[model samples]
Target: MMMKKKSKLFVNCEEAVKICDKSQYNEAGLWDKIRLKLHLILCGGCKKYSSSNSKLTSLCSKAKLNALTHQQKEAMKKVIESESAK
Candidate 1:
């Protein structure tokens, strides 16, 4: 007969974050998502990161924000400088 080993129930912050990111992309397994939720319950920082990542994803999906062009960024910088001068 063969014996099987059980995986650890709790993961460290680093592993937790990796799992969180994977979960964000819908790549994490069911167990991985459960473990991440458990870690977030104990770690405030991880929870905050998870919230922020979720927000950013939501924003990106709603907006077509594919990085600003160099010219557009320069124009924005100029506008900021002019506004600060006023």
Candidate 2:
């Protein structure tokens, strides 16, 4: 007798968001693909979530380039100290 493999459960939008965040859906695996398709079918919320997440990620990447480093902090501290000494 041959044993049958158990199939994975199909999840809703909220679950899909968690799965997507963990990159569990990035692979070309069968279950992951089916989860994505199911999510698209039943939930507009998940669709918006996916789009917004991508947009936020891109904005964060751009903001990172404008962030201050430790050296800049030290330079600002030195200027403040000099001014206070006067």
Candidate 3:
């Protein structure tokens, strides 16, 4: 027997994270918002996870306007290259 495919309208914690990243909570469509709210109500781990991700996203947005210095960029590039080589 073939398994049924689930609809995107019903999302889980990971999907909620992706949706939240793309749209504001209030602006997200009804299904997405409802799914997220339900998950948050039942799952403490997911709630904390979502909160931290939101905070991190806000921090990154603020940092982008006043970006890293050349020295910091170079350091980041070096780190990236080293990680890629490994």
Best by TM-score: 1
Q: lDDT at 72 for candidate 2?
A: 100
Please report, in order, the local distance difference test score of every candidate based on alpha carbons. 0.91, 0.72, 0.76
Candidate 3: TM-score? 0.50
lDDT at 45, model 1? 95
| lDDT of each residue in 1-86, candidate 2, tens digit only | 99966446667666688766655335445676668667767788887877787787778778886767999999999999999999
> Which pairs clash in model 3?
none
| Top-down lDDT ranking | 1, 3, 2
Residues 1-86, model 1: lDDT tens digits: 98866558888899988998998899999999988899899999999999999998899889977988999999999999999999
Give the per-residue lDDT of model 3 (tens digit) for 1-86.
Answer: 99989875466767867666655434677677778777787778778877887898788778886779999999999999999999
- Which has the greatest lDDT? 1
Model 3 spans with C-alpha error above 4 angstroms = 5-9, 24-27, 60-64, 68-86
Name the regions of candidate 1 deviating beyond 4 angstroms: 1-7, 66-86
Candidate 2 wrong stretches, greater than 4 Å: 1-9, 24-34, 65-86
